[model samples]
Target: MDNETTTTYRKIIHIDMDAFYASVEQRDNPELRGKPLVVGGPPEGRGGVVATASYEARKFGIRSAMPSKKALQLCPHALFVRPRFAVYKEVSQKIREIFSRYTDLIEPLSLDEAYLDVTDDKLNVGSAIEIAKQIKQAIKDELQLTASAGVSVNKFVAKIASDINKPDGLKFIGPSAIEAFMEQLPVEKFHGVGKVTADKMKKMGLHTGADLKKLTQDELTGRFGKVGKFYYQIVRGVDERAVQPHRETKSMGAEDTFAYDLTTVEEMNDELDKIAQAVYNRLLKYNLKGRTITLKIKYHDFRQITRNQSFPFPVGDLETIGNTAKQLLLASGIDDKRIRLLGISLSNFGEAAVKVKGDEVSEQLKLF
Candidate 1:
């Protein structure tokens, strides 16, 4: 098939649950409805982050990944609650069932968001926009929750359109409108362009898609590395990536940036205990075991390094993960270095595992 014909006939939709964790909390509890809600660790703790915030809390500048303390400072009255991943996962399964009724081609980015290719839908819904509407309505009717959807020719545009009108919204960006739509989008809004990259782009006077389009492909690649090629095509509303329903989980890991650098071995080990437990929980959730354990460390000056050990047999126990990570840390010679960030990851699972897309820029860039 020709490129235009190939692009024109494709139907992709991106569905994102609005403030998923916070919304689920509000849905289950009448008191949290309409009130600003923060789902994550409580503000009373020293090192807790916000997992998600209700729309009402978002109005006060609270966002996912912000410190719970900062979220509280933004809106002192906002209620904080811990995340119930098991409950959220159960709800996510029901959401996936809803999507399966329309199309089997589903790419779940997380528990709360996914992409569906309805080019050949099971229900014979010829219109992508109509399918998106039906899916949104079904989620509302069946689950007592709201979802926003974006329908377009490809994944990139569809994902961005999904966010234009959030919390129960549907937007369809047709093939003809894709060019103009992409050109006007802010650089920061582009996927894979994080705060650091966006700041760099703005300082270079590249503030919007139009500004980015002005640069040659070589210029972009030279300035931004390999991902610059992605920027070049995406700025013109071109994304050819197919939605892979069975994207392999090459690795699973978690990392944390500290509020203050750790200057002692005891302090660093304490942080590793927390991080390793998190990794263990995730491994258990996916029923995955890995043969490799990697420890990543970032110094106070931002110099980062990784140390990993591979075993003949796969392991997932919390004790093994924690001890291995701590051993890796001490073996790295941290006599005089102050550390600001630490991470633990497991990889080389003997078989395929489901991948949960992470918020890290490095991980997001790998999708392209």
Candidate 2:
């Protein structure tokens, strides 16, 4: 590669906190240390979801988004604690402060993870791997928490590398090794490939990056829509997307999976009211208004669907949100159906209908 080509490779590092919520609980409570701990809602009543599980609890196959009831069943002796978002946010801010010391070009994916572009670092730390080590050490020394870091020439590879080792680990993948690393990766291991997509790929005999690379871009796009183009480039280690520091808010929303299926319209409407309040609170927090409202429903059988309504003017009131969602639900013919989950979201923020950075509000609040 020419000098210009070589210089185009940006040095990026992805940092992910180790089992953030559960780790925080364990750190603050001496009795919780070294024991199987879960941070989320209580497993009693309808049974809430697990927000995160301590490394000790993970040995029993506990994970985030699993039902707290199931987690308990996996490890009956496991301890459950409700999530403390206020404390987690405070610690997240401190973690970002540590990142700011090295580079201003930091893109946080969530409270627990972020990507930092340090090709021209403020501290003149020429080696990306060294910067990652310093940042990890600082987080451990200052906060008494551990983090995993992945250092690479681009965001995609770096993000994947960060998870290769977990609970206080670091992995480095240079430009020269990115291709081979990607080729060896399972389709499920690709950052954005979810279970459904992974199963689809497997059915088609495309199980790894190398398998995916066998198809042309046209063939992949024809099979997987526009995202296939992304897969095509990513598998070849050609992610040119920058580490965007200021990503716009494309949409904001909240969702809840009930403890039991709601069979009555009144119950569903009441649930919508609570969910709308959550979405409205978030809109007010961000000072945003949207012209579109979307309602997502998942039935007791795990089948899902969505309905949306759009208006010419933006709205942010609780009444509009709640009522509109109810209207959408009613129109969707919820009769004789057991509803397990409901969600409300607002979007089309005038000129700010752009890509979002960090986690979407719906994703952040999905377990609520």
Write the residue-wise lDDT of candidate 1 on 183-245 in tens digits: 899999998899999999999999999999999999999999999999999988789999878
- Measured with C-alpha atoms, the lDDT of residue 182 in candidate 1 is 88
Candidate 1's TM-score: 0.82
TM-score per model over all chains: 0.82, 0.87
Cα lDDT of model 2 by residue, 36-101, tens digit: 999887788778889999999999999998989999999999999977877888898899999999
User: Count of backbone clashes for each model?
Assistant: 0, 0
Colliding residue pairs in candidate 1: none
- How many clashes show up in model 1? 0
Query: Which candidate gets the maximum lDDT versus the true structure?
Result: 2
Candidate 2 accuracy as TM-score: 0.87
